[model samples]
Target: MSDTLIDPPADGPTERPLPLRPALEAVLMVADQPLDSVALATAVGHPVEDVVAALQTLAEQYDEQDRGFELRHVAGGWRYYTREAYAPAVEKFVLEGQQARLTQAALETLAVVAYQQPVSRARVSAVRGVNVDGVMRTLLTRGLVEEAGQDVGTGAHLYRTTGYFLERIGVSSLDELPELAPYLPDMEDLEDELERVGGFQTRPDEQPGDQPGAATPTEETP
Candidate 1:
């Protein structure tokens, strides 16, 4: 989906060994984001078919009996990340104790993005009744949300949660979010409900079965 580090193949397949390994490593390294097979192939000057085979090989190598990291496809591209089992050690020392925390503003902005993903910043602001510029910046920095693309009408940047968001939220997919219906309030009772919650927040342990982010019924009227 994005530019990659592999070089385009020469005019023809020369006898020289394809730079498959280095090409993959280069694509994985210094990539601002993940590298998809098509992009990697384009970059490596090899056909996408060949690049894909090489990737499988690399992935299998990492999945061998012993390996510190694994190649994974996330956020629509491929990247090498440490295995989950080593997360604690990596977080405690290698990462200098940095852990992502969502601020109230970030959480609110994230809620809007999650519900109306591929949504423009303008739409998010309209729903939240507050400026979300700062919160959006934080989410981008934290790798929870990213610019999906530009809107068609005004060319406004669209936002969506990244794969990392699912991992952090302990959800495998967006469809896993709980369904909300019974918790929704009637039209006349909108303000009172939000007023009571102090701007709704879900408890961390709340499972997928719990109703969350159920805005008042009036908010549901298109």
Candidate 2:
């Protein structure tokens, strides 16, 4: 009896290469802004901890390189940026004619929405001291604001900023929104504007918070 021996194929699975931390670093190093661990994890299909460790390692390497740029954690994530010392030089190349100047109406509407997200058009109009229908359209079209949804009580469409806004402003989320106090007029000064427009208020004697009518912006990127 002649017995023939057959070769068996490979086992259950082929081995894959381990995750390369340096590759992850290279990807993030060239990004315009910081990347969150979640984003990195998704890209590499690895645990967030792994991605974070890789980022930390890469950051140190860049530091040791003494390049004109470094990694920084901002808006609840990490991003590569030019060294502060090279700001002037970098600005000359990146900021030339690339700056976007928001219109007054857009700014006002954005301010209202940023402060009072999920706010309705009527509320924004109430705070701006003018009809905001047109301005809301502009903000939406410009990708600065979007419809959050309908309010149960009035069924009015709620509005908020888009991811584009977060990226545009170099923030990870609305929580990172800048404090409006410095940019906003005081309650006493805004009284005329508020009364004339007829919007909600945080307190009888204070401006509304960053909510529909009252709240504040903090660094809580999602």
Find the candidate with the highest TM-score and give its number: 1
Candidate 1 per-residue C-alpha lDDT over 44-108 given as tens digits, one digit per residue, 9 for 90 to 100: 77878888888888889888855778888888778888888888887676344226456676777
lDDT of 2 by residue, 1-222 (tens): 759886667685555645668657656744534568887777667778878887888779878988798888898888877788888997685455245576766776788888777776656655565556556655765678988877675455678888998898898977787787366444346545544443333222211111223222112211
* Model 2 lDDT, residue 5, Cα: 83
Q: Residue 175: error of model 1 in Å?
A: 0.5
| Segments in model 2 whose C-alpha atoms lie over 4 Å from true places | 1-100, 181-222
TM-score of each: 0.39, 0.38
Clash totals in order = 7, 8
Every candidate's lDDT: 0.64, 0.64
The TM-score, computed over Cα atoms with residue i paired to residue i, of candidate 1 is 0.39
Give me the displacement of residue 179 in model 1, in angstroms. 2.3
